[model samples]
Target: MARATTAHQLHDLGLAAWFGGTLANAVALNKAAAHSGDAASTGAVANEGWDRWTPVNAAAIGAHLIGSVGLLKHDLGRMSVQKGVGSMALAKTAVTIGALGVTAYSRVLGRKVSQHHAVPAADGTTPTASTPPDVAAAQKKLKQLQWAVPALTGAIVAIASYASEQYRPEEVHRGMLQRVLP
Candidate 1:
């Protein structure tokens, strides 16, 4: 068994936070916000939670990106000679880019909604009829984006799992053999 490096630890830990935090907020915080009394309070509650999470989320993303670069650098030699490794890395890169885009966009929408601190809402993403047009629109977008961030991040996790499997001794041996033989 190989020892885990700093990059490996950071990559897994950061991704775990990125995926788990968003899922928990979507599953629990958003819905729970609705129970905070009036429409305005609901929006405030949700915004407060999300706002607090933003800094931590940014840190997690930064750590993940740094770790990803480190891992890719370390794997370059193997990627060049191992069948399927380069393509798999490319796929993971694409998915990671997609996840980053969704996360950024969601944060933008969240800022839009949060700017109007006292804005009315039914829940984190649900806009009450009295919600101002701009805030309501932002909320609507956020509703969809909330799910998207987690889905895309979850995809990254899945791909990472597959990539890990490719690192097994037998798999690596077979992959290297196929690369040289064909």
Candidate 2:
């Protein structure tokens, strides 16, 4: 019986950090920023926090990728024999790619908002009473993507859970036998 390795720990921990951080930022940090009253200050505070978290998030993502590769290398034989493993792996990969895309897009939108220092009107002037239509549009997009980051990461966590369940000794033996027999 092979015990789990450091790679698996890294993979799980890194993913947890990535998922939890994204959710925390969306639920808490963003709300706090919005509560600050001044729209420009809200953008500044949120942008600053995200900027500070960027390096840590990058490290977490890198660790998860590295760990995923290591785990895949170690489990290639099991994965080949397991009936559902390949499909689950593929799904996880797709979700990961989507999450990465959403993260990047959110950052781009955040940068645009931060650069303007306030939500600009459609005509490119700052609004006094309400959010400018252009800025509102960007914010709307960013809001969607921001929520998406956590949702995608949460899906990955669920996928990982399924993979873990599939790694049980009985499940592994059954999978291998199914492959050998059929």
What shift in Å separates residue 78 of candidate 2 from its native position after superposition? 1.4
- Per-prediction CA RMSD (Å): 1.5, 4.0
Q: After superposing candidate 1, which stretches have Cα over 4 Å from the reference?
A: 1-4
| Model 2 bad stretches (over 4 Å) | 1-4, 117-134
User: What digit string (tens of lDDT, one per residue) describes model 2 on residues 53-165?
Assistant: 77888888888887787777777777788777888888988998998889888777766766666442321212334765666666778776778999999999999999898
lDDT agreement of model 1 with the native: 0.90
- The CA lDDT at 62 in model 2 is 83
lDDT for each residue of candidate 1 in 55-127, tens digit (9 for 90 to 100): 9999999888888888788778889888888998999899999999999989988999999987899999999
The weakest ten consecutive residues by lDDT in model 1 span: 1-10
TM-score of each: 0.96, 0.84
